[model samples]
Target: MRAITLSEYGGPDDLEPAEFPEPKVAPGEVLVRVRAAGVNPVDWKIAEGLLDALLEVRFPLVPGWDVAGVVEQVGLDVEEFSVGDEVMGYIRKDTVQLGAYAERVAASVRLLARRPAALSWEQAAGLPLAGLTAYQSLERVGVAAGETVLVHAAAGGVGSLGVQLAVARGARVIGTASERNHGFLRELGAEPVAYGDGLAERVRELAPEGVDAALDFVGGGVVDLSQELLRRRDRVASIADPEAVAKGGHYVWVRPDSVDLTVLADLADAGRLDVPVDRVLPLADAAEAWRYSRTGRARGKVVLTVD
Candidate 1:
């Protein structure tokens, strides 16, 4: 199978096109024929050895986790799905090696969910990690209906999803983004505020009484910024910064949950949630995809289409 392989941690230039033996399907796993794969900032970070201490890494690694594809085979004891089913998942295993940036991926059944019927392959591929991060953060912070929520980096991959999910929960959302993305946030049902210099003052103007909860997707002191406009400091969360815990806010690291993925799929199928794809490239161009992700300017998700 064709794949993007990295024998050593470095930069985008280290990612190369290569051929590899098919991943072995273990019990409780399914082999998926990859159609599209999501490219995330973490993918590049992992390539640069940024997560060396946290995750076990093997040589000649395939770097990716988000995938939307068709099941070609099911392993033993996997009764929930069968061959020929379409599925998507965040395939973050305990170790790093074989992954979604290939023609096929062997994903554990526990991580699999049926693809949302309304989403295209690219959209479904981009949904798992970012969607879970946003959803889980809001759940951890106890965001509730009739409350107001502030989402930093509101136009970003995770932040955009966070804004929409909060809105779907009946929470009034105030999102912080650049001036260029304000209109985009409004379309997502969020009141947009520019994110710099006076972010706290801007959010205060929008919700003078203060916000009920806040989610920081861009962690350059955003947790602190959120605190300035939050009525309850404990109702703040950050996915990017562990310092959030020091500030009495929750620090979230999204886990792969089949149930949570199903809920996100349901939202997409119900027309209540959608992922915007900023760009789609062929799998062979995975290196370029990493470069683009490092720019930090994508308004939505970036995806890789596999042939």
Candidate 2:
């Protein structure tokens, strides 16, 4: 199998393409022929070795967690799928050995879900990590119908999904984005407010009732900004800053949540979930995609396509 290997952590130059032995599937896992893989911030952060203290890495590791592909083989106890099922998943991120950057990935059956029939492999690949995170944060804040939820970075991967999910849940959403993306956010059923100086005032003008729940995908003092506008402290959450989240009342980290992923798949299958895949590159160009994502300028998801 061809995989992206990062022996050490640094810039885009750290990632290199190489050939590796095909991974073996365990009793409760499935072998997936990688069709497309989602590139995320965590991929690059791990490349820079930020999680080195809490997590151990296998040297010469593959570095991707999300995959959308066809199941080539199923393990002995995998009852829910067979040899030819279309599946998608965000595999465990702790271990560096098994990941979606390879031509094939061995994913645990529990992490796998039916790929939304309406979504292409590239679009499906973008959902597991970003989609589940948005779902979990909203659920944690108890966002309900008619409540005004403020979504920071509404044009971003997770924030875009959060805006849509909040609307689907019947929340009146006030989203913060750049002037260019206001129309896009409005189409997602959010009242778009420009993100910059006086963001709170803009949101207040849009929803004077104040924000009931706030989800921040961009963490540079966003929680504090939300706190200034939101009447209640516990309804605010952030995926970007754990330090701020710890001090910022109600918050949730996007972990490996298979249950949430299942719901997200149903939403995508129902046309409730939409992914704007900005670009696709080969596995060999994984570094370029990582660089693009690091810049925080992507219109949507960047995917790595594999045969």
Candidate 3:
């Protein structure tokens, strides 16, 4: 198997393409032939040792979690899928190594879901992590129909999906982004608001009474801002800010769940959700993808296609 390996904790420059051993298929797992891998900020963050204290990472790490691929072999006791099944998953294991950046990976049945026919391999690869994050955050906040929900960074990968998911739930969505992406947010069914400098006022302008719930995808002081506009202070969730819990709001760390991933797939199949891909690079150019992700300019997801 060919994979992008990191010899040590470093940035994009540290990533190298090399021939690696095939991943082992443990019981309750399946070997997937990788078709596409989603490039996320967490991949580069892990590469830079940002998650050192939290995760157990090994050397020669393959850094990717989001995958859209075909099942090549099934391990013992696996009955959910078989060979030739098309699947997409957020395949984060307890230990971080041998990930979706490779030509193949072993993912647990708990993480796998049938890919939505509406999405391309790149879009499917992009959906798992970001979509799950947005979905789980909305779930945590208990967003409901007819409610007004505010989503921060609404044009970025997770935020774009967040806007669509919230809208699909029948909520009126207010999303924060730059002026350039306001139109994009509108297309996702969100009332676009420019971030920074009286952002709260802008949201208030849309909902004079205040919002019912808020999701902070690009954390900072947005949790506090969300509280100011939220009818209930606790009706906010933050993925980027850990202090959300201290502030009486929810801080969500996305988890891999087959059920949740399936819900997203259903939405995609129903034509209610779309994974906007910003760029698609070859697997060997994983380093370049990381650099592009770090730029913070992508309108949606970035993906790496395997040959």
How do the residues 165-216 of candidate 2 rate in per-residue lDDT, one tens digit apiece?
9988889998888899888888888888888898888888887778898998
Alpha carbon lDDT at 61, candidate 2: 83
Q: What is the C-alpha lDDT of each candidate?
A: 0.93, 0.86, 0.96
Which pairs in model 2 have colliding backbones? none
Per-candidate RMSD, Å? 0.6, 1.3, 0.6
lDDT of 2: 0.86
Model 1 stretches astray by more than 4 angstroms: none
- Give the total clashing residue pairs for model 1: 0
Lowest-sum lDDT 10-residue window in model 3: 216-225
Model 1 is weakest, by summed lDDT over 10 consecutive residues, at: 195-204
Instruction: Please give, for residues 1-307, the per-residue lDDT of candidate 3 as tens digits.
Output: 8999998999999899999999999999999999999999999999998999999999889999999999999999999999999999999999998899999999999999999999999999999999999999999989999999999999999999999999999999999999999899989899999999999888889999999999998977999989999899999999999999999999999999999999999999999999999999999999899999999999999999998
Give the best candidate by lDDT.
3
Candidate 3 regions exceeding 4 Å error are none
- Per candidate, the number of residue pairs that clash is 0, 0, 0
